[model samples]
Target: MKRIVEFMKRNYKIILVVTALSAILWSFIPREKKEDPEKDKLILELLTMVLERGHYSPVEINDDFSKKVYHKYLENIDPTKRFFIQSDINEFSKYETSLDEMILRKDISFFNLTNSRLLQRMKESRKIYENLLSKPFDYNVKESINIDYDNLPFAKNKSDLVERWRKQLKLSTLSSLTDKQKLEEEKKKENASYEEKSFEVIEKEVRESTLKSLDEYFNFLEKELTRDDWFAIFLNSIVERFDPHTFYFSPEDKEKFDVSMSGTFQGIGARLQKKEAGVEISELISGGPAWRGKELEAGDLILKVGQGKEEPIDIAGMRLDDVVKKIKGPKGTEVRLTVKKVDGTIKVISIIRDEVETEETFAKSSVVEKDGKKYGIIYLPKFYISFENKENRDAFKDVAAEIEKLKAQNIDGLIMDLRDNGGGSLETVVKMVGLFIPEGPVVQVKAPRRNPEILPDPDKRVQYDGPLVVMINNFSASASEIFAAAIQDYKRGIVVGSKHSYGKGTVQNVIDLNQFIRSSSFGDLGALKTTIQKFYRINGGSTQREGVKSDVVFPDRFSYLDMGERDEESALPWDKIEPAKYEPLQINYDNIILNSNKRIATNTTFKLIDENAKWIFERKDEKVISLNLNDFNNELAVADEKLKKFKAISDYKNTYEFKSLPDELALFEKDTVLKQKRERWHEEMQKDIYIEETLNIISDIKLLTKGKSLTQKLSLN
Candidate 1:
């Protein structure tokens, strides 16, 4: 994502040497007829080789690293400590420190042992849950369950494990039972004649529902997941030890990664969810072929999928990912689906697969009027780009187009909202930052043993020059940090929202592992995403651990909670490099920040928000919950009462009205779905206190700029 070009350009020789070595070795290795352990060994060998040679800063794969990987893998498989007992741990603990040696020798004995034991334990637990849920729980008894699974030890024996499972299940049912009771009470309040079910009847229903969900979950694990899937998990536990960003993507996962980054794929564009009956249509992407066809609808169960003129394969009891693979194909291909419609009719629906764009993934702008001035707000969900095709839609081009449209409407100021944006293509972000500034360094990336390379906006044309505000939150990461850092460094705009953005400055490149082997009987070898570079701001400060600190910080629920890159144990260290040469703009932010802070300090809504944030921070460590029905109900009542004051947070709205651009308004006549999405966005913005504050800040900046201009003219005269 960050260093694709640089990696290929600089590491061609290293890649060639490894490819030759892997080809020679793979040629001699015996191919197994039964199991795929040979492929696993090859993956381990290649991953270590590439990571050691090509990673930004690879860690020593010694005993310490081995211990971390061992525990992490176990935690991944049995996180709740319910499946594996103390005896299993004792058996697996022998390889805790020797995993490094085992990995180097291409021996997967540890993985083999753990995987088999876990499967057996999972099979046994199924019976325990079924037996426990069969009888009515004594809700009158006082008991508590702690959800801090990491701190809990493995059960000593089978009896202890069953007791642990009982408490967990009881807690879950108790929660559901209370919710159902409240729902029935509300229904009775609405209509006195409404027939309310008895407590026993509701309790039985909750148990049945829980059992169904657990059965479906176990069914998926038993049917869908293969040895390769578990091996992928083990591989990730190894690779992530190098850094949090480094990952091993299985063949199926690699495809998903590509789809996520590009936000476009060739498919019927119906979201599917796995259910006991079959794969259900969760939703249809607007403007997609399936939605346009009108034959497919949400809640329809897909029975089978077929290619053009081919025999359909029944998708009953198939994995959701597998079902999706069968339905999706290259653009302009015909795929027929045998579906059971919501109306209880079974029919075959023919759909031509086409490129479907997830509208929510792209940037959209809304124009809002505040204090008689129109300002534009552009929300970018991610810096998306179609890596396979440049001609396809990208965030940079779309944002630029939106800027032009907003300018045509004669907007006074601009706000770029990057909250909850996890970031995407690095090139897209560089071009996006170029839209605001006139030719300057956007970010400085440094690879291992290499000088920092400045990525600058070569374009001298400035798309928007007036007062600008960039909004960010704790979830805003990588490319988002790069954009915010550049904007802050240039003094070109005000950064607002959370205390700081998500600290994820490292760049990754997905290396196709199949490229290393010339030929293989072992099918697709998948890919690896490894950290290759860490980027810094134009001001020489790295956003690795210390993310871009906002010029004006807002109170949030996670304000005091540890999160982001800093919270990750394997995150790359933050460092500073020599600053790139750039001129900072002369704008007076002192008065603006002071004024905003004064307003926030006294505003009742802000005060309440700050208080709510503290309240949330206090409850962050509350992991234990009462399983007794009366006690659980009391706990929920106390929480509800405490949260009643914070309800105003959602109800709060500004006096300004938000409107869509004229172009979108015209398009809305035909695209009702897009219109509805925009309406929801605009409605949310109307109630957003942060947006209101940003608009006020923009107004202040505009007023300050005008006053300075008049002062300079008078002085010259």
Candidate 2:
């Protein structure tokens, strides 16, 4: 091993120089600027070759596979059934079997046919929505609309398509009508003269809004969507067939993805997805303006965006990227978003644009006292590391430093918070896991055409040997699962939280398409992230579909929700391998875990969480929502009434006073806003039932271990 290390050290520079020279030489090669339509085919050919050569679990590209890809692409394109008709489907069905030939031949016939048909249908549907909206909708009429469009069939003809638009337009206009009615009621309560507008006038105004949105959508379709634009979508359709995680990013999109992953970006810090009505806020970045403001939520639908006192421009039908462009601007600017809540309430919220520092990405420490015993909680959002800059701070180093700080604080116990930490650097995580265990195999990596390599902790020094616990949830994935699994297998710590962490054990490397194309100038060929490896625990169990099982499970709101790796249709299957050489280091986690489980069973906080989980699942199950204003309002009230019981979950607290490490307080002193944010986090810490429970478990561990050294205690077990 020493000889191998010496050889690697000696040859590293030579290898790097050779790689650099290869890249430099490749760039200098003469290339043609081709305007040929066959460029996409060439890209597809290269992508297929790469997937075949590099993919860990390459799937067959047979006729059956081609059919699945065709269906998947169609589902992705017209998921809501708003555009395509039965005849269009019939026309596209001819290539249902021929897609295999097309994929093999790189033929553009299928894409051209579908693209032309979609464009034609879009043009025709634009007129239909306008013609139907010319007349006022009858709100008094008792009619229901099922928005579960995927389960429903496409329009049979142009008349059928028109009816579809009519129902859709009414649903949207109905929301506006209800909002307007509520406004008038509030105005009346304030004794303000509310000009009574006729229902027809309100309907006309709503229709005009819809028209403006359609015009904007079509304008974007005509101008921005080039022939090359859909190629990325087409490529993505092919790559996703292998697995949901495998993806293609256009050069522009790759930059966006990089910016997003950088932990700080000058944007609203809310992930958006296009829905039927508007751009939905998929998630709010922790410590971002959106999360700090707490006005927007994950499920909130953004209808319009107003920039610095500008008239709110409707974003109901706008593309997600376009909406993102409008929402993201320079720091210190203001962006107002008109959002519709889950309960059908519409309101406009203003957010001051600023650099959203993702505190969750880096390791942060806060002291919490339980039963006269102080414990340090290391909240790790991700296994973050900057590959471009070796000097830039990484999660592993920061986490170790934090542990040192906590050690100086004389923390009786340590709890590593890995909840919602969608994994980052694998090397970082292995180093991080070493912070607890003295030395052992952290994870086993099995790559294509390579032997399984057991990644062990090089450091023999255990940072903290106190009663340790690792907290994880359904969102904890990849590297997060690796650390948790290692701890669990080694019996070095107690793993708590959800039944399992997110089962994303696969590794991906983004290959630049432009770099692969020698002497070819096809503009930007984008990047493809392909899964080339899978991770396994020291115990040999793959954390693929069946993620690392928690030592002590706790109920949460996402417990019943389909939130794990197994929930995804295309997720890789879980398997097992030969267990690595590692001995259990835990003393008596069974007793401690049993006690914790009992507490979780009877704890009021958990009971509230259990009830909340059920309520959430029930909400998710209800696909067909009422269109009637009264019924809709009544159902929302019923849901709220039932959900009221679960409000105590977040309100529940224990005797734990949380404070940031003294080193971090200096930064807060300079930034008043950050100080307030930290204060808010500290306040929330008090109410966190999960952390409180973890501290209780730690206190029990300390009591159980008694006067024995942590190493001696573990060795005895």
Best by TM-score: 2
TM-score to native of every candidate shown: 0.85, 0.90
The lDDT per prediction is 0.81, 0.75
- What would the per-residue lDDT of candidate 2 be over residues 1-717, giving only the tens digit for each residue? 000000011223333433554465475444767664667776786677667666668888887777888787776667667789898899888887777677778787788888777778778877887787777776666677887765888889878878878887777677666667667678777876766777667667777766665666666677777776666766767887787677777778778876776667897777776544457775667788888897887667887777877646665444466789889999999999889765444677999998877664467788977767788988887788777787999888999999899999988988999887778888888888888877879999887655678989989888778788899987778888998999888877789999898788788776676665465777777777777788899999999988888988889877886666786666788898899998776476778888888988998778878877776676664556666767766765676676566567646766667898888788887888767877877887777888878888889878877635564335533
Per-residue lDDT value at 136 in model 1:
92
Worst 10 residues of 2 by lDDT: 1-10
lDDT of 1: 0.81
Error of 1 at 72 (Å): 0.5
TM-score result, candidate 2: 0.90
lDDT tens digits by residue: candidate 1, 428-527: 8888888888777898878788788888897878888777899998778888898999988888889999999889888777788887766777888899
Poorest 10 consecutive residues by lDDT, candidate 1: 708-717
Error of 2 at 246 (Å): 1.3
